[model samples]
Target: MEAKKRTKIIDVLGSTSVGTQVLVKGWVRTFRNNQFIALNDGSTINNIQGVVDFTTTDEKILKRITTGACISITGEVVESKGKGQSVEIKVDQLEILGDADADKYPLQPKRHSLEFLREIAHLRVRTNTFSAIYRMRHAMIFAVHKFFTEKGFFNIHTPIITGSDAEGAGEMFKVTNLDLENLPKTVEGHIDFKEDFFGKETNLTVSGQLEVETACMALSEVYTFGPTFRAENSNTSRHLAEFWMIEPEMAFYDINDNMDLAEEFLKYLTNYALDNCKDDLEFLNNRAVEEDKQKPQQERAEMTLLERLKFVVENDFVRLTYTEAIDILKNSKPNKKKKFQYLINEWGADLQSEHERYLVEKHFKKPVILCDYPKDIKAFYMRLNEDGKTVAAMDVLFPGIGEIIGGAQREERYDVLKGKIEKMGIPEEDLWWYMDLRKFGSAPHSGFGLGFERLMLFVTGMGNIRDVIPFPRTPDNAEF
Candidate 1:
């Protein structure tokens, strides 16, 4: 009989089948003394260390191989001397699949800055940190589907090219096909929208809330998990010109239900990543902890990836209305001392990132749901509260990540929605279909859009939004 194939790192550790032969294929992460090859098969989060002797393998072949080269080998699973791991592979036969030039390749065995890695985004995934992050991102996508599908929510696909601005922020990236040379110009020397591809102005969607709302009214429960774009020029670590958002719309739900769903969904995702991506999390923990130790003690005291996730899983999130949060900020020591970058003075002003981070991380010390924002500060679609000044909107702020999810209970009353639309200077004719939802059979509906990349940042303890995503699209930095 042919020799039994080698087992995977995950299976070798789990099974009682030691001293068995296995076949493995992976890229060489690192090589030591021309004897051991650190192999990762992409089958599991951890790589298997393959110890090979040059006496058995051809010296010419072994000398030709280098870092980042793909190889296949047959080996025996044996006990390892590695500090953290238990098993390693002793290889008998080896084949080099690809050759990577040692001098030309950008990724060396040593550490590289995040900024430098981002410059080579195409090749960064091969690194340990990025490999783990990308895998965690994939796991989160599965968790999102699993969480919603288990709850009987339908996954709906909204249009990418939309005619209406969902957020009314006027930050849309326009979709146009009119030639620039002999452009169809009006008598006033302005580009004519009538000559555009869509005949009217169109843009890449900023949010799918409005489209999902229409579907929610029909499907009862629906979600749009896709890319959203904005043309804002801000270059903060948190903001991306294009990002992924998971927007779930539910029929017959109020603002309270919206908060509950957001909390539950976030917890579900955190739990999912903790359970499914243990090895990846372990890799991330080692790196983050090492980096944290080099920082000041005060900064290092913030929650680790595992600890933050456990906190979310174990505790019930604190929920506060915008008015109550304002009162707390008014009476708080941070505001009194003027420690934050932006002041939290009144209820009508939008909450700054620093204030939101302070409330959740410093004061609350956990995830906090801030709801019932000022009507004038929020979008026109939000339901007006009984106080007439605040809208039934909510933003879920985590310890390190502020405003991971933003949503609201939509206004279902036709006349009220119409009046607000008109007063907000939004062309009433554009939202006729939205108003018709209320006229026909609109029920109390609520939903939230969780920035998927931001959620990944929360899961991986990644400091920036750009680091979590594969190919970040920021203003003036669209290099693929």
Candidate 2:
């Protein structure tokens, strides 16, 4: 005789087939009234109620079925008498595969703070909030691949370690295999990088945009999704030591075309979350409302989660140049009243979060695409405009998450790109291969980078960027 197959709790709870015997496996969410048990397998937000005949079951076995305990049950599916759920299981056999000590388990049946959960990140995924968030994250990832695949974009895997700084930010985590205690020094007392692992110098990649651009020159359209590292010492909620980035390069795309793709990409992801992860989104929406209630009236969001998502999908993003945005900010009430932390009084000053939010949420009441930023503030790879001051750079600012996407029409002319690189003081020898791309059959190309964690924060309505990422690598915090 063969054994019956195990059914996921999501399937059994969703099915209407009564009187069917099914094998279910999951962790106990709650054992209520000693007769009912709420079980979940991380499949869906809803849990299946397991009716246990406590009179027949041993007292010792029932005691072990506390919160976070793993269990397997053979039961008959029946119409649920509970109000919250439609179907439940009447248990015939209960087996405790693993027991979570009630005294030792940190995650009891209660609403824990997000900060507390971050401390116990190893076990946080079992909670409803994180479970829903991670599921939504998965859905968004699938939607990203789906959207690109449908548009005939090749998914390229870029290297994790590189010998060049693509962003030229000078904030990379150095990768070396040398005796640091007994250092290798030059005649001038400077560290000799020639003896390093890569023979000169290498570090964890800050961006795959450069490598992916080389791929696009051949594949026409390609994207890279991978981890990127930064060695900044900031401890803010928005900053991370390591993060994931999604960079897409198009061979013949101009700045306008790049803006179109970025807007469509964001809208597609938001709509995907609404359509595929409705149950989770609803729970998160209610959670966000409750969280906002604890804040001051002015700080609370005006629109609900679903409304915000719909707003992005339904409306066209406001398009303007850096000069125009600066004008609006300079004349705005915040600037006149000295309310802005960094006053937007000049044309070349970089826009801060407050300014971006004001433009997107208050001024236009939608997403905004700010373009043609001063070349000094942007990267060297961006196309230098004829004005000689600004580059063809664009930033897609969302309602809450400012600068969700950053990109530009790449500088394809060999002389222009080489001149910009030299002016920026980047090592010409390190990027000789990149210069070769321009020297060869390089077409007019453009690309953008989307911070995966920031997108997650926007979609999940999470306050902190740390909360969205599973294992956040923040300054002074790397707990498992």
Candidate 3:
């Protein structure tokens, strides 16, 4: 006999064919009163209820149905006699696919703390909160590609292993094949990278911006969405050793055009989530509201998740120069009262997350695009302003986590870029090919990088960046 095709819990619940027969498979969320089963297959946040006749079904088989147990139920669809859901499965044939010893399973029917859930990250998605997040994550990822492709941008795959440090941050995970336990050193006592796999030193890429910019030289509009590694030794809620980034490079665009694109792109993504992932968003929004209520009243979110997303989509971002922001920060209540953790004492001070959040959540009451940052603080390739004091750089600040996207207009001048490279102490040979873009035919190109995890945090209302990613690689935690 041919095997029965399994119907998804989402489809089963959506059907009006009350007497239609179907096969459903999912992990049991709960086995209530030994008759009703709350089943989910990660299709949606909500679960499909399965009703079984306890009097007729074998008690031995019923005993195996517990929380986290995988089961296949062949039954007829019927209108739910319950309140929460409209339809349920009437089980005629039930089989335990995988029995979960209720006592051994990490997940329970009750609400599990986020901190506790992180310990079992592998099984966390089986729960309602994480299942919703991963589903929404898929929608966001799809929307990212959809948005860029619709904008006439060619998607490019940049290499993960590279020789040059794009950000000049100096913190990178070196890619190698040489036996570390053994020894290979040069006469200078430095590890001989020349003898390594790549014949020269190579590290996991920190940013695909530099490489994608090369493609922009010919493609006119190109973007890269891929993993980026940073070996920064910080284990903060916001920091991650490995994260994904979405970078778009345009050959003829300037800083102003970059800002406009960033705003539109963000709005498009949030709108996509609102439209495509409404069920998941609604669950996450309620979760955020409940989470917020536990916090001190003054420390709670001023706007709920849905409202926050709408604020970005419905309103124009407030744009100002870095100098203007500095002046405002200096005179602001937090700075005057010495409440800021990092006081705004100078014009060239790097704006931290606190400062960025202040500009967005408190001062502007809307998303803000900050431009014209001090040249010294920004990347070397950023366009040098006429005044020679700042660069044509811009950072888009959102309400919850502050800076979500950072970009700048490229310094197209060969001499100027070369000078900035030297001044920064970066080897000229390391970026010889990058300089060639300027040498051959460089236009006033511009691009910005949106941290995918940070965007996920804002979209899902998740607190830690680690929770937003499936397997978070932090400072030392790489366990599966």
lDDT values of the candidates? 0.86, 0.91, 0.93
Q: What TM-score would each prediction reach against the true structure? A: 0.96, 0.98, 0.98
Return the lDDT, model 2, position 128. Answer: 91
Q: What tens-digit string does per-residue lDDT give for candidate 2 at 1-480?
A: 112898887787776488888888899999988889999998899999999999999999999999999999888888989899888888999999999998899999988999999999999999999999999989988999999999999999999999989988899998889899977999999889888877888899999999998899999999999999999999888999899999999999999999999999999999899889999999999999998899999889988887888989999999999999999999999999999999987889989999999999889998999999999999999999999999999999988777889999999999999888888888899899999999889899999999999899889999888888899998888877
Per-residue lDDT value at 16 in model 3 = 42
Off by over 4 Å in 3: 1-3
Off by more than 4 A, model 2: 1-3
**Candidate 2's TM-score:** 0.98
Q: For residues 62-125, could you state the per-residue lDDT of candidate 3 as single tens digits?
A: 9999999999998888888899998898899999999999889989888899889888999999
> Lowest-scoring 10 consecutive residues by lDDT in candidate 3?
1-10
Indicate the worst ten consecutive residues by lDDT in candidate 2.
1-10
